[model samples]
Target chain A: MMPMKLEDLLRTKPVFVNVGVRSFGDSLREAGYQVIHVDWSPPAGGDQKMAELLDDLL
Target chain B: MTLKEKINAANEEALRRIVAANPVLVDVAPASEVVPGMRDKLILHSGPPVTWERMCGAQRGAAIGMCLFEGWAKDAASAERMLAQGEIAFEPNHHHATVGPMAGTITKNMWVWVVQNKAFGNRAQCRQVESFQQFGDYSKEALSGLQKWRDIWAPTLRAAVRKMDGVMLKPLIARALQMGDEMHNRVVASSSIFANAIAPILVDCGRSKEDVVATLYYIGNHPFLFLGLAMAAGKAAMDPARGIEASTVVTAMARNGTEFGIQVSGLDGEWFTAPSPRVKGLFLPGWKDADAGADMGDSAITETVGWGGAVIGGAPGILTFTGGTAEEALGFSREMRNISVGRSPDYLIPALNFEGAAVGIDIRKVMQTNTVPVIDTAIAHKEPGHSIIGGGIVRPPLECFKKALTRFGEKYKE
Candidate 1:
């Protein structure tokens, strides 16, 4: 369970890096914590076929 | 080299051409005389090649208006019949080294701003923006405005351009970005800069006081006066990037009210198209979203070369017309950077702490990030005989970029 490490992190303030969905970061900001939000979404608008095609080219 | 490495090399080369381009406003002249291959019976419309039967309502009305302008028909009914019967040849402005906004109808006798990319020695042209007929009003009043351009405005401006030996457009465009002009939907700063440079030349033109007064007054007050010239500059700058093997930079983006299309650098002489999408925009009084037409215009050329929506961070004032918050505008600029090859060396934006404008749309990054380019533009009424109703922001259909990527895979054997 990593009790030692989990207890140590709980003992201090935490800075967060949030990706995609912004609500998570906003919630943290509301709670008076530090958060960095990354504006992102699924590639090719989440079309599986298009995503595969893009991967092939890459 | 491997395919990935080869593609990177080609894209870098294409980006070099895009950033190195020096587009100069060389002249104002008739399309028949300046645009390559323009002919007496031909009318160039916006977007990709479309048949008369498939033409949208606004475009159809503009076609009839142009026919009347060319003296091919005496009335709208007869003009519509001629276009329907295919008696008059129709082609896209992009096919003729030209571009125009909205309905984008350019007849042989129409005057156009000519821009030459001094770096590559290739030129492009675009007709001046009309207040009404461009969006399909063909009333006697609308047609009279065309007569004014034909009879009065064009000749006076042409003389000034010749006397000045051509205006250097790049410096003005660079400065406009700092003054909050995206160079597409809003060009007030560029308009003023153009007027400031040409006012004295028009003064020494030795014309009648009445003539110079009318010309200067119109130029000074018209806010979008520089958009067509900037569009020609975009075309002139981007054309040289086309035909670079393995390059995935988008060379052109246009719409014809019915469909939206794009061209890639490696895929020369080809277009990827999808049905046109509606623009979410703020409308004029008594107008609603239902009254607006589908996205249309050759003005997306500005975004291709990274001037319009790509640099919106520097021009938050456009948000009022295009409908977005200043925060969103700044976000768009940052997002565009992810899709482009790099920032431009010439056009810099203050909002980003003086970073260069985003330059060179790479289709690969578009596929990678699933982000399409944004365009700030004016909106027209959907009906055949109405004029502009509003202004807004629009994006090309994702299908266009997806199809381009699929074709890229096949062409490069990736």
Candidate 2:
């Protein structure tokens, strides 16, 4: 049997949470959907050393 | 103890100090008299420390204007030579426990508002906001405008504040938040409240009648006057939270035209800096983003403590100035909510269903969520010698936050 929740999700509109590029959220909203922009960037802006340090933290 | 536990406990302590803070309008005095280590020949600019050669346009202009105001030089050319020759000393406002907006140029003789955190027993000072000088214009008219502030406006304000014997700021800022003041870019409510509350007291401040009238008019007409107080209050409140070991809570954020910088509670005096970002929003007529400078000001101190863009959801009134619909402004606040540790109980946001204003930005959350603090500030011209070109929104570079978090990890090695 297929997952019941997937069918429910498709039937009702899903809220999109766009992780970066805020304009994606704006575009989604303009296309008649609810969207939340995360205003994200690469972990540590793609700095290998800094990303390693961040990964080491709590 | 686990690293997570250490961060959690330390951040709790920082927020304790922040919420317990009671900043009062304590006094008004010249920078030399009150600013720690302020000297006759010294001028202070905003953000982390930056030197003359790297100085942005507005800041260079403001510094030259200050030199002229101090009578260190009779002409702009002379002042430029003296400043360049190291004949005069300048420093960042943050280094001296003070803050300012825009170019943030303040000098030895300029009068400063002193906000004392009554609970923390520390004081923070900032000078009032005037139009031309902060944007780096040093025309004779602009210089003369500052002269009038030194000669007339400052003295009247000083007398009135002294007579009031310490107006309480927590209530005013809290109330103004309710009245739709963003407490950074648009401070009409707080400025108006301050002027109205002081008008009657100025009657007893003992200046000549004509002087009092002119001073009241100045205060009433200027909407940005209270932006300086919010900066000083933020400084006063956040100072006691400094050096809370293991805390990832940001204690300060600021920008010079060249860079944006921040200090973490655990890091003490060290600043994590990144290149300043351009503002994205409405511009005054005949100007666009090209004419805008890199974001600059010491005013992000307000947002660090949870006001301005941190709670813009409740301040739709500023949307008229910064250009956005109310729901979009609320969306920005919801995004800010993702990075903050929690909401402040004392400062409430009605539009968010009377939720307390989001407070205590946590670096861990910022990194985990990949969100930086949202800033609402005015755009100064990239080159000096111009007035404000526009108002808009901005953010500190993510690189600054990443660098800060990396350093925090190094310092807290298990």
Query: Which candidate number maximizes DockQ?
Result: 1
Model 1 TM-score on a 0 to 1 scale: 0.95
TM-score of each: 0.95, 0.93
**CA lDDT, candidate 1, residue B205:** 85
The count of backbone overlaps in candidate 1 is 0
Candidate 2 per-residue C-alpha lDDT over B1-414 given as tens digits, one digit per residue, 9 for 90 to 100? 888788889999998899889999889888889999898788888998898889888899889888888889999999999989988887889989999888888888988899999998999998878778898888988888788888898888889998989889999999999888878987899999999999999978999898898899998999898998999999999999999999999999999999999999999999999999998878888888888889998999999999999889989988777888899889888888888877788888888888887778888778776778889988888887888888888988877888888888878976
Give candidate 2's TM-score: 0.93
In candidate 1, which residue pairs get closer than 3 Å at backbone N, Cα or C atoms, i.e. clash? none
Q: Tell me the lDDT of candidate 2.
A: 0.87
Model 2, residue B67: C-alpha shift (Å): 0.9
The CAPRI classification for model 2 reads as acceptable
DockQ of 1: 0.62
Report every candidate's CA lDDT: 0.89, 0.87
Off by over 4 Å in 2: A1-52
Q: What DockQ does predicted model 2 obtain?
A: 0.40
> In candidate 2, residue B173 scores what lDDT?
94
The CAPRI quality class of candidate 1 comes to medium
Instruction: Write one digit per residue (lDDT tens) for candidate 1, span B1-414.
Output: 887788788889999999999998888899989988899889899999888998888888888889998899999999988988989998999998899899899998999999999999999999989768889888778878777777677778888998988898999999999999989987989999999999999988877778888889989999889998899999999999999998888999999999999999999999999999999889988889988889999999999999898888889888788899988888888889989988898899889998988888888788778788988888888888887888888888888988898898888883
